[model samples]
Target: MKIFVDRDKCQNHGLCAISAPASFQLDTDGELQYQESFDDEHIDDIEDAIDSCPLQAILLHPDAA
Candidate 1:
């Protein structure tokens, strides 16, 4: 899957990081950083991250069928 974050809408809340540290992180500046694509094994973590994002900035896009 592909992950996207609306940087303009992110507030650096770190919920995404908490939910999926392997895929999402808060940088030294406390900005959100994440992998653009992740393995299927990480889908559940990514989903949790999407749900945990307080600002709703995280988005997931499955590959085109």
Candidate 2:
């Protein structure tokens, strides 16, 4: 899957990071950063991250296509 975050909407709350540490993180500048693509095995964690984002900045795409 592919993950996308609306940088403009993200408040750097780190909820996604807390929900999916392996896929999401906060940069040194306290900005949200994440993997664009990851193994399907992580779908559950990714979903959790998406759901846990208070700002609703996270978007999950089944495929880049």
lDDT per residue for candidate 1 within 1-65, as digits (tens), equals 68989989999999988989889988899887889989889889889999988889999877677
Residue-level lDDT of model 2, residues 1-65, one tens digit each, is 68989988999999899989989999999988899988888889889999998989999877846
Query: What TM-score would each prediction reach against the true structure?
Result: 0.89, 0.89
| Total backbone collisions for each predicted model | 0, 0
What CA RMSD would you report for each candidate? 1.5, 1.1
Lowest-sum lDDT 10-residue window in model 1:
56-65
lDDT of 1 at 63: 68
To one decimal, what is the Cα RMSD in angstroms of model 2 from the true structure?
Answer: 1.1
Model 1 Cα RMSD, Å? Answer: 1.5
TM-score of candidate 2 versus the correct structure, residues matched by position: 0.89
